[model samples]
Target: MSASSQSEPRLLFISGSSREKSFNKKLAKLGENIADANGIKGTFADLGDYPMPIYNGDIEVNDGPPDNARKLKALMEVHTGIFIASPEYNASFSPLLKNAIDWVSHIKDGGLQVYRTRVFALGAASPGGMGGLRGLAQLRLVLENGLNALVLPDQFVVPKAMEAFDDNGHLKNKENQETFKAVIQKLARAAHVLHG
Candidate 1:
């Protein structure tokens, strides 16, 4: 790749759901489109592609980071921002998402402090009325402590997510579409400021 391409900020999109037809995945894609439209390069990181057992310090020390964990950390090092589309499991962030974060955080001298100073944004979708709002709230707290980055206050939550998408997999809800745009704009702006 050219030097310019190499220097462009890469946005990593992490989908919390592993289901084939996950609404959070759809929302993540929407966020990616918004980022691309705003001249930000976005790439999706599939959790299923990296299946590590639930995080345990003993297991990590015994086997070191799984290949997937190493690959994810490498991507995080190059990316300018992380856009997480989480699904509410029960009433909080999904275990899969938490596990991914746990693995990524464990790298860098085997501590989560490596994520400090990174930029991140959170979004969630669900069939429930709250639209995974509770989950996003908790996620913000974790990201704040772990990533040490500014997360946009305006978050996107798609209620009744199954009905929020069209046959082509594009988000159909107007309010959510606007919220997604705003969130991406804020992330891009923050990333630019931090990058400079």
Candidate 2:
């Protein structure tokens, strides 16, 4: 890469649910820890911190995006890669996550740089057998098709999430831990190649 394009890749972790003890949140935290252990810089962001009204075109025209939307968009812009730990709502991703994406997409930019330029990885934690994989499929579709973002083909999923982590908040199963690390490392490598 040229000197101007050779920048350190940073990963941002976002949890879809805002509950204090959310399983998805724990998964995101574990992702950060794994990324750190592997020498990748990652930041964990709580979506609750960036609150915005439900998306509506009328609201957008009347007041523009809420301040929180702009802040979240800016945050996404800085990171070269993003990992979203989404909770399954029915068969889809959580409303909170969908809303955040909707608001960010309406930022009035000529190009959807935040969504288009970043490499995204999707993961989920659930007590159910599928580990929210169904929801993750939907999320990947949105990121890749709706927003024209480049997303990794592999994803980490934690099933029986309540029992997936140990006391120290690391994955309890060794295989699961390795799987998670592989996915995260792949994202880091891809981000560096694309953005560095």
RMSD of each: 2.6, 2.3
Where is model 1 more than 4 Å wrong at Cα?
Answer: 1-7, 109-114
Candidate 1 lDDT, tens digit per residue, 33-135? 7778778888887788889889988988988877888877776666667788999887789999888888888776634643664578888989998899999
Report the Cα lDDT for residue 185, model 2. Answer: 90
Clash pairs detected, candidate 2: none
Residue-pair clashes, model 2: 0
| Residue 103, candidate 1: C-alpha displacement in angstroms | 1.5
TM-score, predicted candidate 1 vs. hidden true structure: 0.89
Candidate 2, residues 120-141: lDDT per residue as tens digits?
A: 9999999998999999989999
Estimate candidate 2's alpha-carbon lDDT, on a 0 to 1 scale: 0.88
lDDT of 2 at 194: 82
Indicate the residue-level lDDT of 190 in model 1: 71
**Per-model lDDT:** 0.78, 0.88
Which residue pairs collide in model 1, if any? none
